[model samples]
Target: MLLAQRLPQAGTRPSWPRRLRAWLPAVPALLFLVVFFVVPVVEILQGGLYNADGVLSTAQFARMTHTPVYAKVMLTTFWIAFLTAALSVVLGYPIAYLLARLTARARERWLLWIMLPFWTSYLVKTYAWMLLLSKTGVLTTIASHLGLIADTSTLAPSMMGVLIGMVHAMLPLAVMTMLPIMQGINTQLVQAAETLGADRATGFFTIFLPLSEPGAAAAGLLVFITSLGFFIVPALLGSPKESMIAQLVISSVLELFDLRFAGALSTVLLLCSILVFYVYDRVVGLSSLSGDAPRPKGGQGGRALPVLLAIGRAAGKLHFHRAGRVPGNRGLKLYTWAAVLLLVLPIAFVVPLAFTRSPFVAFPPDLFSLKWFGAFLSSAVWQAALWRSLAVGFSTAVLALALGFGATLALSRMSGRYSKPLFAMFIAPLIVPRIVIAVGLLYLFARLGLTGSDAGLVIGHTVLAIPYVVVTLSASFKRFDWRLDDAAKMLGASGFTRVRTVLLPLLASSLGAAFLFAFIVSFDDLTIAIFVSGGLNTTLPKQMWDDIQLAVTPTLAAVATSLVFLVAFVVWLSSYFKRHSY
Candidate 1:
């Protein structure tokens, strides 16, 4: 039988129908992506090379790059992104280190602290910074009381404030990305170094730091790419002088009414981002982008690792410390806590400030009031947007999870050669900037008459949510026990019965968690909403964005507070399922 199985049967050909049946599960997701994601991106990129009459032209591109102000904006965007990425690395490394060294239970506790803020709405977090940095806000009040500056001091709407907010937002991502890498490092090597008459500093510098560089590089890439396309933080807390590529792309449409120019700029930004992403993927591998523990094969970075380790050893030779309480360790821990404090401060102040009786967004309330909360509950505009957001969010989550789960099943049965490209396709949306996705989708949806409709918004959110859902469900699928399926088959259970009674039951938690994540992502999405929804299809984030632009009302704080609690509750529920469902 083994020999017969290995030999080709005479007059036999592979069954094309069977092969097609195997591919069927992947077709829906592939077709959906082709029409929605791929088509829009093609339209946006190709639009840059054409004129208003639909004729091919490079005149727009020439004009855009040749303009002095536009060129300056490009340079400024790069500078800010580079600075933010570098700073996030410096600030987040200590926290990642602390997390890596802690016991498993302690790591989980601190991880929740980092991830809770990560799961909160970006707009709410930005608004929290505004409340703290405004002229009459908490920071200014403290500065005045301490005689550090005048009572008129204000940090909001300044480049300084933008940097602060940007860094705060980027730190948690940096830390989480690096934590896996640090955890993968072998502590035994460091102990070996210490036993060879080297101190803790020397062991870390020579043995640990070099091993952790890939993670650091991955963190830097994540932060820089995200910073390049920032909209909410800079839009709310930054001035015109600090405008980024995303803001410019938006202004080109809404303010200048230059769709061609916006398309050209979007193309340029997208190309630059893709170029960077390609380089990072080549250097670090795309696996890191999925938060995988990178196992870098020997290459240029590996060759240079020895040189870095030498430098570390040299630095360690200059510092001698007694074994009792390693030198600077306590100070390092202190700095780690300080960084965590800065990361959490913006989120911590929103609820308290929302209840303040004062009309302005000031801290330590002069009195308490529930009027802001009442306003959010009673106002037609707020209620309508809230309901629309919930509806769209629910739809997006279900659609994404369904598509993602099907794709995951198909991928599991595929050969590595086929799976690799499919995986990249699924993850591409996550790597691309939201600004680019928004512009492309807007252009395509307008042509299809889906713009400003709930269907359009749901489709947009589903596109954004699919990558995350795929990542989550892939993990669950991989962990699934095939032996149980075999047992069911042996017991005369059909494929559908096995899936219903076994696989579904086993993966329930993962599916639920993925659904919740998708919902939160769609609910908090402001960039896509800005392009696809308005008037009748407004989401909570879009409403908040408009309100912030018009005025920082107390009611906005109430909305932020409400969203924070709502999202926190959902996240907590997801975590509960994740813990017990498996």
Candidate 2:
């Protein structure tokens, strides 16, 4: 009774055990980051500054800098990134603006349509594009019939093919980034501008465009940064000229087995990303980008082309006959069906080919059996690898969410001076190429005996995932009300009690959101997983990548389909939970 009274007394010191108890939940996260994440990066930095024996030196970096091949690869990476960034912005901005301007119903429907790409696995999307655009693909057959491709081989794979495929994969990301800010734009402001007699075009360019600039730039930065280290599409669907930094890094580490050179190359890629970000910040003001121009009071888009299309619809209605609607959305139906078929065909190709009576993977596969799938599914090597990949993805997701939550909390708690730099530091991963982080992890983990371990794979993925989690949670956290804490404390709550009962309750939803988002990010993650998981720990995406490179098999196709269904199911579950919970 005396001790309890003293504990509640003013200015009395808290017991050490109680404070330690409060910290227990956060300990696992802290330990994981320190041992796996922090150590790996430090190792990479140290290795880059030293030789194999670990003596400090800059010889490796110097050699890499002088190599003309590095210069060429760097240039190629830049050009491809720039092009992809531009295309993503071009395709994404209009849709984002439309999403912003539309009614809730229209916006939801449009967004779902845009998100259809997410329904397909990234691997499938790329492979499908290959089939759709390949010499023996549907495009080839049609082109040949029309005498467009005199030589079928010309359409197999090329620089342009890689560009098209990457753009498709990247466009959805660009749209997502811009959608939030666009939704916040004030329509009344635009109406007032129109009332002041400004033309729509003039008002849009002067007002709306600048307001949406920040969102656009952020989206563009995301697309550009991700494009810098693109590997799969470039390797499987592109010519040598299209090789990106990711492909180069993979070759250096795996084929050449030279960790030193890989680390140096990765450092260069990261430095280049930092340079781009610095340049972007200087050139484009981030604030004006998030704002939006006012919407007109009257309905928008009264353009001539739209009117002509409307007229055509009316005429077709008036000319209604037995065959009144021959094209009855037939054009759109054809386009949609064609795209869906093309998107799914590659994986579909692998299924039958896997069971092909013929040993060689070929079209018009005579084989129609499940032998390969059975062999792959039954093999201990594959079974172990599959389990390893699943474990790595989940562990990475957990690691990412923990650090992201703490960092975001710390960031939210901070104000003014230290804020910008810390926020920027968290944001740095967005632009820093994966090659840089991968190399860093490889070097760093090797010192700690973490290489070829599940711990290393988790660290690599967690690092890659942190930026997204931070960005997502930070956006939500910034809007959170701190008054709730005050309210809880006024009602007789202590710091711990307030956090648990008040803060955590409010943030629980966001935490869940962040976790699921992080999970998908980790699941789809290939770069860090590939680099870090040397032997014992292999991720699904990495395994899929190996199979693609070594031999494209139908069992791989089935794997791709399974992965697709998994992602889609998770997304659906998330959506359902979001609706019921939020």
What is the RMSD, in Å, between candidate 2 and the native fold over all Cα? 8.5
Instruction: Tell me the spans in candidate 2 whose CA falls farther than 4 Å from its real position.
Output: 1-68, 104-106, 113-121, 285-376
- What clash count does candidate 2 reach? 8
- Kindly list the per-residue Cα lDDT of model 2 for residues 173-258, writing each as its tens digit: 88778887777766677568658864444345445565566677778887888888788888888888777777777888889988
Best by lDDT: 1
Worst 10 residues of 1 by lDDT: 2-11
After TM-score superposition, the amount by which residue 279's alpha carbon in candidate 1 deviates from its true location, in angstroms, is 0.7
Kindly provide the TM-score of model 1 when superposed on the true structure, using C-alpha atoms.
0.91
Report the lDDT tens digits of candidate 1 across residue range 15-100: 66545655677788888888889888888888888898989999887886788878888888888889999999988988888888
Model 1: how far residue 448 lies from native, Å: 1.1
